[model samples]
Target: MNKKRRLALAIGAGVAPLLVVTMPVSSASAHGYISSPPSRQAQCAAGTVECGPIKWEPQSVEGPKGLTSCSGGNSQFADLDDDSKGWKVTPVGSSTSFNWRLTARHATSTWQYFVGGNKIAEFNDNGATPGSTVTHQVNFGGLSGKQKVLAVWNIADTANAFYACVDVNIGG
Candidate 1:
C-alpha cells in the first residue's frame, strides 16, 4: 500500500475503537427530556434559559429514584436545581400537557408529575417501552401563582429515573 494510504488506514484503525466505545455513552445520555411546558433543562437546551454547564447537555438530568431535586440529584448538571437561574415558565392553566421528547425510549415503569410536593399526575407504562414522544395531561387544581413541577420518568428494570423541572405561572 502507498505510504499516505497506509497512514490514513492506521489513523482510522486507531480512531475506530474510540468511536465505538463512546457511541453508547452518547446515545444513552441523549434519551429524554420534558419538552412542553418547557422544563428547566428544556429551556437550557433551547437556549431560552441561559445556564451554566447544563446548556450543553440538557437531556442528561438523570439519577436514582426517590429524589426530589430538580436536577435528578446529579451534581454535574446542578444548574437545573437552581431556581435563581431565571428559567422562564410557560404559563399554564388548570390543565396542561407535558410532552416528553424521548430520543431513546426505555421500558418505563411510570411517569409522575409533582407540584407543591404532591403528585398531580401519573402514568404507568407497566414494563412497556415508551415511544419517541410521551405526553401526560397534568391538572393543577387549586394551584396558583408560580410553581415548579417536578416530572419523573421511572425506568423499569432499573433503579434510575429521569427528572425534569417545569416551572409555570398558573392562570385560569
Candidate 2:
C-alpha cells in the first residue's frame, strides 16, 4: 500500500474505538413514581428503608398492565412487595393528596389506586402527557387506620404500568 494510505488506515482504526467509547449509551431512563406519602420504593430511595435494587431506581418498577403487586411484577424490585420491610407510614385524613414525580413523562391513560384488592380511585388522562409532577386527590371512602394503598400509572401507548405502594395511617 502507499505510505499516505497506510497512515490514514492506522489513524482510522485507532480513532474508531475511541469514537465508540465516547458515544452516549442508550438506556431506559426511569419514568414516574409516587412521591408524596412516600411509596415503598420512595422510602428506599430516600434511605428511610433498607432495600435491594429498588432503592437505586425507585421509578422503574414497571411491568405489564393490571398487575396488583407493588413491584409491578418485576422480580428485580420485589423488595417493594415485602410488607414486613418496615416502610414508613404517613398519617393523613380521610381524603388526601397523592403526588407523583416523573423523570420521563409519557402519554398516560389512567392513574389508579387500590386498597385491599378494591380500587378506591382513578383519574383518567385520556392519553395526555403529564407534567413533571402530578397530583390526585384520593378519598379513602370512610376507611380508617393503617392501610397500604397501591398506586398504578398506566401508560397510554404501551401495555405497561408503573407501580408504587404507600403506607398510611388514616384519621390517626
Candidate 3:
C-alpha cells in the first residue's frame, strides 16, 4: 500500500472509536425503572407479571410525553397498557416513596406522578443527573382504592421521558 493510504487508515481507526464514545445515541436505551413499588415493567422483570417482550428489558420503557398510553408509548411493550393483566397492587398510604433503579443515569428535568388522570405530585430535578438509585416521596392526596399511577422521568437533555406505571392500593 502507498504511504499516504497507510497513514490515513491508521488515523481513521484511532478516531472512529473516539467518535462513537463521544456521540450519544438518540434512541432509547435501558435506564430507569420503578423497582421498589414494582412498576408494571418491574413486575414483568421479576416474573410476577407474565408479559411479552417487556419481561426481558424492563428499564427500556421509554417514550415521549403527551401520549397517555402505558409502556412508554412503545407498542412492543403494549402489554403494560392492559388493565386486566392482574398487576399486583402495592399497598401504600397517602404519601409513599417511589424508588428508581437507574442503570444509565441521565440529567433529569422532573419526576411526575399521576393517578386517575389527575396529577398528584411533581418534583423538579433541577437539571441534575440522579444517583444510581433515586427515591422521591409522593403524596397521593385524597385518592383512595386501587388506582393506576403513572410515573415519569423526564430527561433534561432530550425530549424523551422514561415511564413506569405503578398499580397501588391507596389504603390497607
Candidate 4:
C-alpha cells in the first residue's frame, strides 16, 4: 500500500478500539446508595409503625427509593440475609404468607430489601409513632408452583431496634 495509506490504517486501528472501550453502556440497575434518609413524614413511617432512623452503610445509598438505608435494630430483620439468614416461607394452596419482626437493637438503622440477593424493595422508618406490628406481603403468582424464593429486609434508618417478617402468596 502507499505510505500515507499504511500510516492512516495503523492509527485508525489503535484509536478506534480505545474509543469503543471507553464508551459507557446502560445497565439494568445503577450502582448507588441512600443519599439522605427519606422524608421524615413520607411512607418511611407507615401507620404508627415506629422503625426509627435507618443506618446507611455510607456506600448503599444511591440504590432505589425504599433502600437508600439499612435497619439498625435487633429483631427479625437482623437475622435474615441473602447468604446465611434465609427467609421463612409460608406456602398456600392459592397463595402464601410469611411474618417476622425486628426488636430495637441490631446493626445499621435503615430500610432496604432483596429477593434472593437481588435488591427488589426498600423503606425508611423513624420509629416515633405507635401502631400495629409491621406486615409485608409478596405475590408469587409469577413463579412456578415449587420455587424457593428468599426475601431480605435491608434496614437503613435506625440504631439497633427493629424486626420484620415476609409473607408470600402464590396462585392467589
Q: Model-by-model lDDT, in order?
A: 0.85, 0.90, 0.86, 0.33
Candidates in order, TM-scores: namely: 0.83, 0.84, 0.82, 0.30
In candidate 3 the C-alpha lDDT for residue 108 amounts to 90
Candidate 2 lowest-lDDT run of ten: 21-30
Q: In model 4, which range of ten residues has the least summed lDDT?
A: 34-43
Ranking by TM-score: 2, 1, 3, 4
| Candidate 1: pairs in clash | none
Model 3 over residues 35-76: C-alpha lDDT tens digits?
988999899988997998787778888898655667888999
Q: Using lDDT as the measure, what is the rank order of every candidate, best first?
A: 2, 3, 1, 4
* Prediction 3 global C-alpha lDDT: 0.86
lDDT for 64 (candidate 1): 96
For model 4, residues 106-168, the per-residue Cα lDDT tens digits are 233334444444544444554333222344344443453433333333334432222223333
lDDT of 2 by residue, 40-89 (tens): 98899889999986777788888999999999988888888899988889
- Tell me the deviation in Å of residue 136 in model 4: 1.0
How many backbone collisions does model 4 have?
74
